[model samples]
Target: MILKLVSYAGNLFGFLFLTLSIASGLYYISELVEEYSEPTKRFLTRAIYGVIGLLVSLLIFDKFPFKLTVFAIASHVLYLQNMKGFPFVSFTNPTFLLSCACTVLNHYLWFKYFNDVEIPPQFKFNPNYIPKKRATFSEVASFFAICVWFIPFSLFVSLSAGDYVLPTAEELKKTDDPTAQPKLRKRTINLVRVAINNVRGFIRSSLRIFGFKIAEPEYDRLSI
Candidate 1:
């Protein structure tokens, strides 16, 4: 019983540590990119074009399956649509959501293709014959890093959560009460900042549940 309890505790600790590490890294990258949004946007635009060219080259050389290569190219074209409002992404946008779905689909299809081994007719009858070797873990990982994940990861780092458009003076004038003060606009922060805030909030709540007093963080006052 003691051993089981210790194992559970260790697993929980490791999970929490990993989660915090990833969240911290994301927050740092998001913050850094927020400062150079224009340059990052330009670079990502060029990168998307380059990826498309790579896909075309692979297709021309018969390196990748024709249908799969075409699909990959189409997905990158969709990725370009997401750049219309670069650095200010709507999580609910159809184009953004579709691009995300394509990323997962592309990864799944390519991974399956790489891992599959097809035996020749002669090999099928011969017990000693072996099919070509499957892609190694390192090769699969590198392919995913360069082709499947590059754009999506870059977008995540460069895109902001969103910003509020201040109400126009003409619209504000249409309000029923001229004397009433306008409601405060909620401050916009990047996704990384939001994730950090949520993690901090969860920690505070957990501490409170354990009968410990925790002060609220002043993250709300700072701009991302």
Candidate 2:
């Protein structure tokens, strides 16, 4: 019983540590991308072309199914449409939503393909025969990291959330001031930051519901 309890505690700690680590990494990447938005946009555009080329090559070599390859290429084309505005991405935009859906669809299609085993002619005739092996976890994960999730993940980090909220009076005054330097308000809105803020607000609200008084800080800051 002691060993089982210790094991459970260790697993819980490890899971929390991993979650924090991933969140920190994403936050860092988003900040870095915001700082170099132009360069990141250029790199992502080139990456899209490279991915499309790779898909075409795979199709020509018969490495992947024709329909699957064509679909992947088409999806990449749709991804290009999202890049027109580059760093400012509206979550409500149809193109962005469609690209997100395509990402999931591509992962599902490729995963199913890789998971299935192609039986030999002799094995096809034998009803009792079963394949002993399929694509390993590492293989599938690597494929996803490189080919499937790369672009979407990069986009998430690079793209800023749209300024959906109305500007305050001070902001309007700043905009009106001829001597004041123009600020890229849109670029300042990081998706990771927005997500973190929302999560924090939710937690605070939940705590209030439980009769816990958490002091709301003036600036809910994140260490980049």
Candidate 3:
């Protein structure tokens, strides 16, 4: 159930809705960016940009839109009261279906908070803060490289957590059992296996990304 929500979704209803949202999101953002470019439009536009940034952050994170969005909306109302001076909760998509709800909520929040503010231009959205630089091939290659690396690194973290952390039973065992020595040895052995597996994954992924064909998918998958 949870996995179904996180998988890649291209179109809303087949390809039609996907194309529409992408077009609309880009247009809405571009128009907002252009309008916000003017000196007097700083406050209103900054709020809009913040909303867009939140949406992108959520989509990238890939969670369900509704769950995290409710959190973001509630967070926004709190922000107006507390004024954290930073966007803390508006990021997290939960899933692609969420983009719609998030976008609407963001616009509503922008209007509510900044529709009438007349803040000065010196403190506003710099292009640097909201990067618009076109990503090159190297950037994409690096991204895929990192994604592949992340899968293994994440597994390694789970597997090796025992090394830095003692199981509850072991801590209790150490007090009364003189045989606690074997516990440490078991921990070391587990760490060694994790290290070997993690390194193997990284090397295998790195080789595959760069087009090297030597490594087999499975140990026995190798051809003689």
**All candidates' lDDT scores?**
0.81, 0.82, 0.40
* lDDT for predicted candidate 1 compared with the true structure: 0.81
The worst-scoring run of ten residues by lDDT in candidate 1 lies at: 183-192
Candidate 3 — which residues are off by over 4 angstroms?
A: 1-135, 161-188, 191-224
Checking candidate 3 for backbone clashes, the offending pairs are: 58-92, 58-93, 63-93, 63-94, 63-95, 64-94, 64-95
Error of 1 at 88 (Å): 1.6
Pick by TM-score: 1 or 2, better one:
2
Candidates sorted by lDDT, best first: 2, 1, 3
Q: How many residue pairs clash in each candidate?
A: 0, 0, 7
Q: How would you encode candidate 1's per-residue C-alpha lDDT over 1-224 as one tens digit per residue?
A: 99999999999999989988988888888887888777877889999999999888877874678899889989989999988887778878999999999999998999888977777676788988867667678977986887789998888767776656567687689899989777645334676676677767787899999999988866563334
* Prediction 2 global C-alpha lDDT: 0.82
Question: Candidate 1: RMSD over Cα atoms?
Answer: 5.6
Give model 1's TM-score versus the native structure.
Answer: 0.76
lDDT of candidate 3 over 10-33, digit per residue (tens): 333557676556545543543343
What digit string (tens of lDDT, one per residue) describes model 2 on residues 1-224? Answer: 99999999999999989988988888788878888988888999999999889778867874678998888889889988988998888778999999999999999999888877778788888989977656578977976786788888888877776554455668867675668664544325887877876777788999999999999979865422
Give each model a TM-score.
Answer: 0.76, 0.78, 0.18
* lDDT, residue 2, candidate 2: 100
